[model samples]
Target: MASELIPNAFLASPRSVRSSLVSRLLAAALLTIGAIAPALAGELLPLADKAVVLAFGDSLTSGIGGSGENYPQRLATLIGHEVINAGVPGETTAQGRERLSTVLRDSRPGLLILCLGVNDFLRGVPEAQIAANLGAMLDLAADASVPVLLLAVPAPGASQIDPLFARLARLGQVRIDLHAMADTLMQPALKAGLVHPNAEGYRQIAKAVAQSLRDGGALISR
Candidate 1:
């Protein structure tokens, strides 16, 4: 683990994210819909029958700690579609940006579940470069006309999506799930390690994504 903690300035839900519910409640009460609430749900992903979902990210997406049952695998069962796990351990945003084009071409997916960028945080990459890499990936997906559902990957010890992720949703014109991993990583029972989640945690993340798909008007079977 990196000795230096990520400066709180970059944190979206800087707290344990367990407190986000209360924070949002207060925001609502104060009539201020700030970045804390971010874009949890927005435009729906255009999913087709037998839609192929390619989940792209890092070790978390690959089921490193989940004993082979990762979130994408659980999500495939949840949504009744062919979900491809396209995760690589220790991948940074720049690497993901470069690899995404090939994955998008090969997968030819109808929907993309992107849970990336946290690795860049761990490596202390400049925030601007990370944001640029993520933007480029979103552009790639958009160019393919593949709808995306981005899950904001939080930093270790933090529960909510990074603030930059919120901006990406707007720029990419994509729907985002800000709570799934944030909520999952914060719970000790849900974690397999300090950051990665176990099978059950992955299950909950799948459930959350499935719910978002449903809410976004995808006709998911269970």
Candidate 2:
């Protein structure tokens, strides 16, 4: 069940849609959501004691279309730490993979929240290449002994997440929040444009991530 994967990951944000029609649509669409199976046996190196959280991704993670507050910023408050925003606009997975080592060396964060691959998907990049690049980043994190939390980005307007993210999560590289992006981007009111989200939308994403961490035992309840 999805509860095993993310523990109530299907709950939609209250502010995502305003209209009754949109709300009903969003709710119906997200009902088909998929979970990233928890396949890891070994635990992460205690995320609660970790001081810094590095949020890595493209424009969505950068606060584009948001009012200067991105999900990472919102997440910092929720998690009680600084979340280094390493977001680069228009970046694809390949480019992000190329730059990740340097960012990792510089930030040396205790937790790495990866929210990538959307640009690659939009650019029509082959799925295999996208997967390979994402896998490389995960490998880099493992090599550096840093823990990871993957935020899955579904194809735009898609109700269900692609199986690719689930496959990657199955590798035990990270605990994956498999539905936040899909839910955030699918709602018209929550979106700033076709791909990016507004400020409140980013907050919704942050809240979902915080919840996922709590459920996975990376964060203790306050």
Candidate 3:
């Protein structure tokens, strides 16, 4: 009887397990959205045809696995604006910080899409340092009066909601939830390698970003 009870305790019904996972994911998403909604309540950012959006990140933003088109390219079509892709493969936040001033000066973009820090996280860089680097980037954008849409990338084994991102959002920064995309990218079909997304996956990411921007009132129809 004791042996039978041990097996029963160790085994869970797949359907019930899936249901519980879905529930948890939904709850996390709701909590994150609720936390950041207030920051998005600001006035809508109107874009002109000539307005430029600078997308800065690592290889994920540089279109590593996609078929020559990345999120920024798809985003440009969705929003009818120019999106300059400024992604460099294997770039750390410190490197990004060093190059950002030149990119900002050259692009002089109306808006900035910042997605970074995955490499830092993977390399065991301290979270506080990562946050500080990102905060400095935000300061640069603020100084230039550039509206920013920050995309939060989760570290492996992390929860769908990130408190660090929530804190930044509360401080008046706009953020897009990328947890769903991260989950999707984990599937073999959507992934090109361990950490990169395929073309279809890239398209889905682009759509998510576009929808988030629209929902956050950061992009208005031209």
Candidate 4:
């Protein structure tokens, strides 16, 4: 027998079972309202169908120093789904991991866009600890079968964290080179600053990530 997909209704009231069922049916009917047309197993799922896009990181992910466009918010428009911005400014890898349980329990995101490490580097935290915290979060996501897109902080004018980004790649993990993307933002035309990007820069990063997923055929069905 095909395994029965457990309904979330058990969390609702017994007296409301009929109403709950009706509501789900209505929701199914209204699903098209968001223009997020559901993708079936036979069809490739669009970015919109991806369960959740969790933006977990520091200020950059929080849109700090930027005007109004954060990468995660822009990524949502590009990908078409609910983007949960869990970024807290001034957060370090340890703090992020400490808060990971709340985010995981709340969203159960399908994709975790991790943008940490800058604070750790700034505070002169040991690189090994940084790596361990990150690896632990990645493991958490892995345990839940959620894919990750790790974005390392860009090397400052003279300092580069390319080694960290490369490590993620070497591990056969999904990682995006936002450092390079940030480099693009540093261009005279797209210049923002050493820390955050402008709207155009966020768009560039989002487009790059979206294209990466498209190219890799990483969009998965829920």
Candidate 5:
């Protein structure tokens, strides 16, 4: 059975919202009612050891609407370690694949948290190609013996990418369906269409990631 957990509501500081517009009332509600999933695995890695968490993705990972409330930074505190934010605004899976080598070379993180593909959606890129890019990235990580956590993208509001995510999951990638958690991330305050997450959004993503890591046998409990 799927686990059920939600985060308490809190006001998110205003930040730039790019893209589609959301209703103010709705955005407000989302920020106030955001929920989080349960932590999946329990201490896959020793708590005393430091983990290099690489946050790879587009502007959403860049903290687009959240100033400093990016998921990776919030995750650092949650996981108690240094998280390297490797997200670039307007980057697609293809660009991410092209730059993977440099990111890996520099970060060499023990744990990699990949959140991408939003740009691809914006550009109407084929889902198959997007999946291919993701697969290539995962393959590279596998070759390096680095554990990977793949965050699934939202289904473009009425468009779902579960099939793509499932394909990646079948290949042994630890997957978290951020799409399914969108309700928790969406509120009255999030009228902007761009792929930014508010504080509640970050909390939901972080919680889902933490849970997936725990369940996938990738992390250790405190």
Candidate 6:
């Protein structure tokens, strides 16, 4: 019985050693990925002075309630690039997804600023549909080799930030957290209406976006 137990222990030791080695390798790989992810996530193509950035969204992008100074226009001024406002008032994510290809064809922009889904949130659209529509739009941009900057729009009265947009940002390799600027602009003093920002608010948003682009290494020196 003692001899049989000794062989069993010997047999088990190799397996245990192999398992530990595999675990160590996996941990090292995970650490490597963790260290590199931030830089990779923030990487972007260098923009030319005249590069076009397509600001595609709904009413907020259209300067509704703004002092004739929408975020796109403000961003154009801040970045010194051509930011084409492709926003349509009262548009939903599904509508934007459907219309995006045509706009891409027409604009041929180097970058895309996606800020839709507010109308969908207002209309009680499901989060899944919203994500799916946005994903399709990202896929379209990917096909065109256009880098995207994702702006998260929160639902009214929500207690916590939505995770879907951040998840999509990682998957799409685009900038996230632009929603924080939107939230800042949503303050009563800055907001012209319940949903849209005023001129000063738009300027602030543009500044935040420009800084984000610069930090992400996306903006080229003019």
What is the lDDT of every predicted structure here?
0.72, 0.73, 0.66, 0.58, 0.60, 0.68
Candidate 3 runs further than 4 Å off: 1-40, 157-161, 178-183, 186-188
lDDT of 4 by residue, 133-181 (tens): 7766765665565566666565445343435444543232444544435
In model 4, where do residues sit more than 4 Å from their true spots? 1-50, 175-181, 184-192, 220-222
Q: Counting only residues 3 or more apart in sequence or on different chains, how many pairs clash (N, Cα, C under 3 Å) in candidate 5?
A: 34
Once superposed on the true structure, which residue ranges of model 1 sit more than 4 Å away at CA? 1-34, 40-42, 220-222
The residue pairs in collision within model 1 are none
Instruction: Please provide, for model 5 over 1-222, each residue's C-alpha lDDT reduced to its tens digit, 9 standing for 90 to 100.
Output: 122212111112122331111222223323322333333332233333666878888877777776467777877777677888888999998999999878888888887777787788879987667767786776566556566666767646544444455445433334445542354335536423445666667766666666655554555555
lDDT of 1: 0.72
Instruction: TM-score each candidate.
Output: 0.80, 0.80, 0.76, 0.69, 0.72, 0.78
Which digits, one per residue and each the tens of the lDDT, describe model 6 over residues 86-171?
Answer: 98999998999899999999999988888887788889987667777787787677667677777777665454445666555544
The stretch of ten residues in a row with the least summed lDDT in candidate 4 is 1-10
Using alpha carbons, what is the TM-score of model 6? 0.78
Which of 5 and 6 is the better model by TM-score? 6
Pairwise lDDT winner, candidates 1 and 3: 1
Best-fitting candidate, scored by lDDT = 2
Tens-digit lDDT string for candidate 1 (172-204): 556777777778888999988887899999899
Query: In order, how many clashes per candidate?
Result: 0, 0, 0, 0, 34, 0
Positional deviation of residue 9's Cα in model 5 after best superposition, in angstroms: 39
Output the better candidate (2/3) by TM-score.
Answer: 2
